[model samples]
Target: MSSTPESKPSALNPDNKKAPVTNSMPEHISLDKWADTGYEWAGEVEPSSFQRLATVLSTDHEQTKTQLDANLYRRNNVLHLAFTLTGNVWLTCQRCLQPVAIDLSDDYDIALLENESQVRLVNEEQDYLLLDEIITEQSPERLLPFKKLVEDEILLKTPMAPKHDDCEMTVEQFGEIPEEEESENPFAALASLKGKL
Candidate 1:
């Protein structure tokens, strides 16, 4: 969650950036109902639950286990979320062009707005998210699915260009070398010839 820093009394949960994200609360619910009691839930969702996540990952291999925790609460009628996602992942290092093991760990705080008009109420608060839903007479329902919410949030966190601290070009990617591979590199002879010249 990216938001402007503020110390106002009505500041949407200061922990939005530190918050964990969720699933299984329900397809949709009356925002007013949950806000009254300050509903909270935390749990892990399976890797397969992130259908969009797979397409962005670089590996043909399946994603390793991932764990996530999330809490939803509100301040002054403004919905806020704190989410944490952690686990192991294989991402291709943009520089090395090889799989790099990344220990996935990230936290997000998001303030969800019911309508753009409400932005003024909490515009100064950090990480505010307002979705513009197209409502028509045939499809007037404006509720977004719980699963979609989680997926959208997580997907936004994916790195555009994942990389390792050091690119290991000196080493061969395939560890096991065949017996014949013991031969010196063909470039070695070229270098030796250059020395003689």
Candidate 2:
């Protein structure tokens, strides 16, 4: 919670006993006293808390890559996080329904609420969280939905599958459908009764 530079990370030593940072983009960052320092997203996350690595692969297809212009600051008891994420991603193609390469970039400005159970509900009229400087007895209960944002950004930028102008599957692959069989009209039997009326 102190603003001293020593409290900030400078460079990550793999041998250092701390969280394993997954990304290499912030290599010069130093984690002095955070647990499992590398991969863990807990504690006072500083700009240098991350590594200088380019990619942080959380899964086979899901990752956080590129430079992070992010910082964690606390004014009073409230925390504020601001950052921008830009990177290339692989997402499902919208057209062919296949994996497609995509470019993603997103900017975020989040006010960290201090309460353990702050209401996540937001006003529909405003685009920002309308809460004041709330004192939190615990770590923030809510954070900007990061994964969802990345997924949405990727989905928005994804191209239709088989993005090439000409796909391999040709028109011939679509076979023609047979015509429908004709059936006798049910009204035909009622024609005789109409004449009698």
Candidate 3:
């Protein structure tokens, strides 16, 4: 496998200018205004920190496309993000190195912590966080890292190389070796001795 670095944790920082961007996604849309309004975010999930967890499944002829389905619930200053993801992706087969299509469907359950004093801290110890109330400052974008997770799962499922189950080696593939020359038993003299007995 190629050693090109997968996106790093620092690359996820929305403020990181060093992150390489091949595709352009509009700067994150804020969740603050949509919080109490009972609106859901539905659009093309891009190559952001959260979206990186979810691999967009597609073919060479298609682009990365995704749909975000979620219910936003707020109570006692907590925001609950609940959603599902559906998409397809093309991955190299481990065995034959051929392109294979992998489909994905995922459910997301996340909560954001909130406090009034405008205090925001990322506790690596926790899986979720407090949501932001405004778009002015850099807030962690509420994207689910579906792609990366999917890629990992696929890696565990795929074989080292892909081949048809019924495939057999052709004569040309066997090359010039004769069947007698390929025999494993070198003790032909023992067989002759048994015949003399």
Candidate 4:
């Protein structure tokens, strides 16, 4: 494929690891173009920038940022992506209902395919993603929402039920389990009236 004028030397060079991250990195891009051109991008986005994540956050993160690095290239005519997401976030502790700080770090090397028919392109060492599942909002098989993709990775890393290893709150403090008290049954009065009748 012929290179576009906007494609820079660093973007053209798939092995250029030292290339600096730029503000020109787009939140979304054409998956076809990125793989065809061997595009690479790196950036840090605030955790608060994530719409779904922001609502679940329990701590004040005015300064925290999630680091994201993505590299897309074609090998043997199959597109591959090397992606990383690392950052710290705070979630509500299920035990005490307080903020519990968590550190997230993950790395993924995945094969991108348009459908299940292309699954043979991937080997055992790599994971794979079907465009049919992820590219719903955009074009059928072209556009990729990179920002949401990274956010999804972070969400996967988050604990399902987050709680501190050592909770400071006592049993009474956490939430008191109501004690069952012995009481008269609701049907007792009816039973007595029925006997009298």
Number of the top lDDT candidate: 4
Can you write out model 4's per-residue Cα lDDT over 73-176, one digit (the tens) per residue?
67767777677777788888888887888887778777878678777777877778887787777455577776677677778878888889998764556677
TM-score for each model:
0.56, 0.38, 0.42, 0.69
lDDT minimum window of 10 residues, candidate 3: 1-10
Tell me the tens digit of each residue's lDDT in model 3 across 1-197: 11111121232233422222224222332343344433343444432233433343223334355454445555445555555666644554545544555554566555555654422343344235344432235445554333433334434443444444544534345456665657556688788798788
Over 1-197, each residue of candidate 1 has an lDDT whose tens digit, in order, gives 22221122324344323212334334343343343334344454555556776666666546776665555666767776666778766666778777766665787677777787777767575777764451112334444344566667666655678778876655456676657547668898898899787
lDDT of each: 0.57, 0.39, 0.42, 0.70
Best by TM-score: 4
lDDT minimum window of 10 residues, candidate 2: 27-36
Model 3 has an lDDT value of 0.42
Alpha carbon lDDT at 145, candidate 3: 32
The full ranking of all candidates by lDDT, starting with the best, is: 4, 1, 3, 2
- The TM-score between candidate 3 and the true structure equals 0.42
Better of 1 and 2 by TM-score: 1
Candidate 1 lDDT score at position 175: 72
> What is the C-alpha local distance difference test score of candidate 1?
0.57
Colliding residue pairs in candidate 1? 3-127, 16-109, 19-82, 19-83, 20-82, 20-83, 20-84, 21-83
